[model samples]
Target: MKVVNKGLRAVAVLEACKGVVSLLVGFGLHVLAGHNMRQFAENIVSRLHLNPAGHLPSIFIHSASSLTDARMGLLAIGALVYSLIRLVEAYGLWNGLVWTEWFALLSGAIYLPFEIYEMIFHTSLLGVGAFLINIMIVGYMAHSLFSQETTDNQI
Candidate 1:
């Protein structure tokens, strides 16, 4: 790949690594929470099921629905999808792929504020690093893209 692309690739790899780590940790937590939630819901529903109070059926139905709905499962799946997409964009960034870079630029720019907010509200080492890294990469990529366009216009 070209030197520019090589630099992009480096950035992309870093982003991908970050995404993978976050997704795995999130997934683990989701699973643990899901397990506990299901158990609690089941226990409550079972007791309600045994009681036959007029409202018991409604309670059991609601509790059963809550258990089976598995919002945690949906959250885990969403996180997986987002993580994969981010990694793909990172690959594009690493190789200095124009379209990939643009995608990364727009997406990164959008997320930058959220990251900043997170850092300001809840400071942490990783959050600070992520905020700074995203700002730098997005700025660099935006410049590279615009400059290339300007150069091409003169040609």
Candidate 2:
């Protein structure tokens, strides 16, 4: 079945909206993590040579370090990249660019397997929703991109 321009626009809006939400969420995580890290620093100051190494303190220290570590940076970068991708998709949707449709669909499809695994492992309703949305977007993207190819070849 062929997908229409409206479908493309709707998909673009949906994808871009998700990016905005993700950007906000990533910022929220950074803020929350920063708060926890500040509290950890306070502990180090007050305990000053009192307990060189205690289990709970050590765990907190490690947790704080891990939370602010490289993975967080990677996550931040990923969020930013996805935000740009979403913006590009929005533009592409407005212009009716098939490349954007293919890109969004392919990327969305790539995300689904991981999301599906997360839904099963974490058993979260949110994860399930994300997986389902990705699944739906994949179809629209694929249909639009595919139809474009067929039309182009006829010319």
Candidate 3:
């Protein structure tokens, strides 16, 4: 159906966007690995007018200060791997691959528990939005898979 194809394309675009963001983040981490992260955090807090002594700002600075080059490199590598998976899924979905529907459904569903935990505890608008969007994508993928199976059986 046209509607189903459109939904797949839309989700493919979303997956591609997520991949790009992760890729950018990996590149950023790579670039920042050898830099003065504490000073960078301080600069960010200063530019944002956040009190350096404040709890969140202080934690940010401390966390940044504690980052080792090895740790940063490992995180960058993890982000790169995540980006690659997402991009591949996006490509498969764009091509209407059945395997990609299953992949998307499983991947999206895997985050549901974590998202629900975040919504229950942190309760941020961004967290809620991510949860809703992920759930919708998972549901759509499931529906698409089931419809395909039914069509195949009827044929």
Against the hidden reference, what TM-scores do the models get? 0.64, 0.64, 0.96
- Alpha-carbon RMSD, candidate 2: 7.3
Candidate 3 has a TM-score of: 0.96
The most accurate candidate by TM-score is 3
lDDT of 3: 0.94
Query: Can you tell me which runs of candidate 2 are displaced by over 4 Å?
Result: 1-4, 26-65, 69-78
RMSD of each: 9.2, 7.3, 1.9
lDDT: which candidate is best?
3
Better of 1 and 3 by TM-score: 3
Q: How well is each residue in 105-129 modelled by candidate 1, as lDDT tens digits?
A: 8888998889989998999999998
- Tens-place lDDT digits, model 3, residues 43-118: 9999999999999999999999999999999999999999999999999899888788899999999999999999
Shift of residue 110 alpha carbon in model 1, Å: 0.8
How many steric overlaps are in each model, in order?
3, 0, 0
In candidate 3, residue 106 scores what lDDT? 97
Tens-digit lDDT track of model 2 for 36-139: 66466547845675442567666656666666645666676777777777888877776777677778877888888799789778988888888877788898
Off by over 4 Å in 3: 1-4
Once model 3 is optimally superposed onto the true structure by TM-score, how far is the C-alpha of residue 64 displaced, in angstroms? 0.5
Q: Which pairs of residues have clashing backbones in candidate 2?
A: none
